[model samples]
Target: MAEAFMKPTVILAMTMGLAVSARTVVAQDTERPERGREGVTAPSGGAGSRWGGPGGGQQPWLPPLWTALDANGDGVIDADEIARAPESLKKLDRNRDGRLTMDEAMSPRPGGMRGPGGQGFEAGGPQGQRPDGSRGNERFAPTTRADGTLDLAMLWSQGRAVGTGPVRFSHPPMRLEDIERITPYGLMVGGHVCPIDHGYFYPRPLTPGQPHFDVMSPADGHIVMISHRTQLTGSTEQQRDYDDYALHIEHSATFYTFYDLLTQLDPAIAQQLDDATRDRFARRQMGPPIHVRIPVKAGQVVGKVGGRSLDIAVINTEVKLPGFLTPRLYGHYAWRVHVVDPFDYFDEPLRSPLLKLNTRKVDPPFGKIDYDIDGRLVGNWFREGSGGYPGDGRDPRGYWMGHLAFAYHHVEPSVVIVSVGDFGGQPRQFAVKGNGPDPAKVSAKDGIVKYELVYAPVNSSGEPIELPPHMRGVQGVLLAQVLENRKLTMEVFPGKTAAAVTGFTTGAETYER
Candidate 1:
């Protein structure tokens, strides 16, 4: 028999540090005043009101149902008046029952009271109704009707994942046990798809037209060539270091835009044909065209007109690699480019010996370690930020650190083992540094890494507490010490007074590359 996953249950125990209580559900009807009830007024006063009001009095707070109920137009409400409104009558008779019972009126329909695609309150017995009869803890709760249908308006009002937000693309509600059965390889949430590898390495495939390359040595770095047609390029590197040490590298890239040359290469892109992209390429009316300009070793402008000159470089531009990954670890790497006119380009990982290089181990004089998190060494978190809109003037347009980073092509989700520490610094300040396989020589199928972390909290007294065999409803913090040769005490802040402080640890392994 298939194991049933446990459904998320609302725990209402003082020991659990949750304050939840059952409450009575009630319904009430209000009367409309001639001048509109207090807190109810026209959006605009007097003549500005588009629709005429009762006796020329604007009624702003009148809900559509209430408006429909006010059939007599006396600017007052009563049972007779409500009965006269057909729409209100239909709404009140939710089950189509002759009379409106308290249960029928209060119970939400399968589709919910909100419109289509709306999010509604969680369905079940009413819980957590305040003395004033308001709901709390609704943020994490699903908005649903009593019958389990979602409220379309509420869902839409919650907003869709537009640019970027956590929880976007998250899996729908499922029982904890069922999650494993349905998503054996993990699940995709918030636009991120996490496939389960169960501690295996699987490389992604390279797109067409891109060549394979490798890193022969650290000094003999690979060269990246870019052209108008080449939008993106990606490479992977893996290495193994026995001793743990922090690594940092400085890098830069140059971008070239041919304002005048683009005008001549493709007149359509040069002149904006549509008002929408008037400042962009002329092909704005038609779809933008892709133009590739390969630079020769030596070149001079053969023709000059309209203040336009065409010049290309052996290597168009460069960008620095942020923090390094641990050695022997295989992870996907790629560079993406967005062309102004033509389609975007992705320089897929190359699988060629020409780009391959053996990494040379270098030993830099150790700098004095200043920061350290005093705790059992468990795991670490490192990230090379990616996938975000270009920075604007106010904010540096680039990926923000701490956004969950993973490869899209990989068949399995990338495991990230984060070591919780008490070092009270900005989160995501740690780095992973090491060498790995030459990206040019390895295929996407060969670059993969698996990692996971388990955290246990310790009490404020620096004593480890045994958590209940089965515990829930606890939140805490972890700190780390980053500076070399420095010991720093870290603390975990568990909201539960009786919560245990069990240390946590994470395990990770690299593959292929």
Candidate 2:
């Protein structure tokens, strides 16, 4: 049976209505001890009040244990109760004295890695036993015997660590319903570029007016540097997409050079350009910088083009690997343009037109995908219908924007690799690989490509695990999807049978392309 824990909010809300106003007793049921904690042992036949007296002790801490164990309304644990107690009760003997004191029973340490008695013992007893084991030393495990009596011993023997106290039982810091905004770190830049006469570049149709889109920056940022006639010194393979239009952008920490944009600009814009920029423009080598932030607003025109699309090429940005230097997109690169559905950013009227074309009606044919068990924002999807093109291209036979793969192992950190590909036939591969930890592996079987990359474990909020530090580990799986309504509807659960695709879902998403 699946176990469920109450959310902190639910627990707090329930306690609010159940709490009773305290009534002042004309005479105290039991005389107050000069100085002692709750659950203190009382002399035999004394007042049977809470605080470990008779009437089945009712101190808030371990009330059930005290009530059940202290049979015949005696506050203290006599030899009879100790004899029938479970093995876990022995752990509360902090001094190794083999007897549980009020202080030891009241205090519970953190859960999970924290074991009983402050020693690294397993949190609970073997399975099939009652819930009396130490689950991370914090809360007690609730258990009952066959006779319907609250079994204090069974709780101690079978308790399993759940989580740290107070914090664990409290409501999560951020609930899923409270969050409204989601951002995509990956962005794609689109524009026209001319092929260099240099070496090692991929083949293109090179049509006179064909537009190119690259999985780079969605838009540009402030210009920080410019160069004129900078010697195109790298070898052809290293400078594959070389453009004399090199200039740096601040927002994305990257560079760009658009070949077709140089001559089209008016003198007003060109006068602001540096001498080097003007000189490069005169030679028809580069264009002025166009800075724009990502998640471009719908209907917001940053530039006007004569063609239906733009051609994007991955240009040169030097990266230093252990053994050598190579050209790559710098910083945290995101291919958002390809991975995100354009409709997500549009207003209802704007998004409505696209939805009508999608054919899913009533709502956009989309869903949100989350991992880490916690409610961390991952990515969104739109069902691939007849009118829609796979925005983050996974369609093997068509021009695709990108491809992503995940590899998982029981032991080793999980790995996620996202790469972009072409619109060609089957058996396509990515031209660039993202930077990740070591021990990554890649393979393919039956047309499905698999890559093993580093994946660090996350917390309840889906952020990387850190508080306990040692709790972090790796996990990964290959993602294979089935599409509909021009969007992704379901994916093959990795590690299971290759053909088994189950579960239906939809939502607005931005990451994990």
Candidate 3:
């Protein structure tokens, strides 16, 4: 299974280290005459060192065979040439699959260089032994014919037997398991957010032709919004620069935001897409998040972007408030707290299982599980419903109200709003209580779990002089759940309702455990 998951040898070599290709080696040799390749013409430099070094049975032995397979006389042997060539098909296609896959083509045959009887150089039967009863581990020169040069017969014989036993490769397909193994919290390979040629600072101007990296959905979810060509042109920066392509997957528990995609369109095709589907694409460009809720499997190609540099932010909208909040006795003051790192939940392997567990025995097993909220509330938490912000609706521009930290113990739980440059001042907490019939029970059933939480008007103090009415005293009903045992997604609706489903939400909150 491990071998089945590995990538092709050449790609594995390239990514594993700085193994140059045959063309690359030749180009380098051209510049530095001293490092010229004499008879060694195979892909045999940095990569060979990974196994045992070129001199120690790692040398590229089949020059003539390589040349023959490379129909265009190119240094590399591509899949097309291998498929068309009858010699390669007969000798390499071990399973008779007709088409040549990378693994089948690179796997070793029972006999070396020669078919069973043809004599060029003979290695032991899959045990790395030479015909002379010596171990093939020690490098031995290939025997030449009476003419003292290699011929087609000898080349075919030796090439057929060569095997890559020691060189194991690993480039797993980007499935949920593979992705979790590689980057549980999602990857930060691309640099921080980029706003085109604009300076590297907050509130940079947006531009078209910005680069976006191609990505598959990490899990099953709907494609709620996709922004291309860069601007919504609304009143605020949140509206103007709020352009970002996003995938809402995993039951809306997680969403991936792709920023700074390039302005390239897909190639002209024989068939055109539907109007509604084509409309989602920015700049009339083809590809990606084309439709809502198109169920895609792990590692399936959703779309590609034009840029090499990509910024993918995974926002887990599931947030849970800490349990054990006790009333305070001392003076209350705002305390600045850091937002929880998005990837921190991944550190706890128990929070997420690596493999799928057997759920056949448990009826309706994998939906929303009862979440135990038992940790400190000290990480970033975003209020749903702002463009580029969590939640829904198209609010113009608003303050970033960075990550929040709520200390529930201090008199009236202190709240801290993260800001730019300088630290924020003190914070004031809001009223949060269980919405159970008893109003004291901390836990509730899976469906219709309710929470009574009040919205405040000021940033740090209860004294509200004057501010936007939107920030005024507001009371609402909450639809809450501990989703996937990792975080919570709660939808706040106006008025105290008891239904399992709701029409719309005034606000939303995702708290990570």
Error of 1 at 51 (Å): 50
TM-score-best of 1 and 2: 2
RMSD of each: 27.5, 30.2, 25.8
Q: Higher TM-score: candidate 1 or 3?
A: 3
Candidate 2 per-residue lDDT, tens place, 255-308, comes to: 221212111332333455444335434643311121111221212222222222
Which candidate wins on TM-score? 3
TM-score of 1: 0.16
| Per-residue lDDT of model 3, residues 404-458, tens digit only | 3222211112322111100121122333443123212323344345544454333
Compose the digit string of candidate 1's lDDT tens values, residues 258-323. Answer: 211111222222131223223222222111121111221111211111211111111012322222
Error of 2 at 497 (Å): 20
Off by over 4 Å in 2: 1-269, 286-302, 311-342, 354-513
Highest lDDT against the true fold, candidate: 3
Where model 3 places Cα greater than 4 Å from the true spot, the runs are: 1-213, 218-229, 232-244, 250-273, 280-291, 305-397, 401-513
The lDDT values for all models are 0.20, 0.24, 0.27
**What's the CA error at residue 260 for candidate 3, in Å?**
9.5
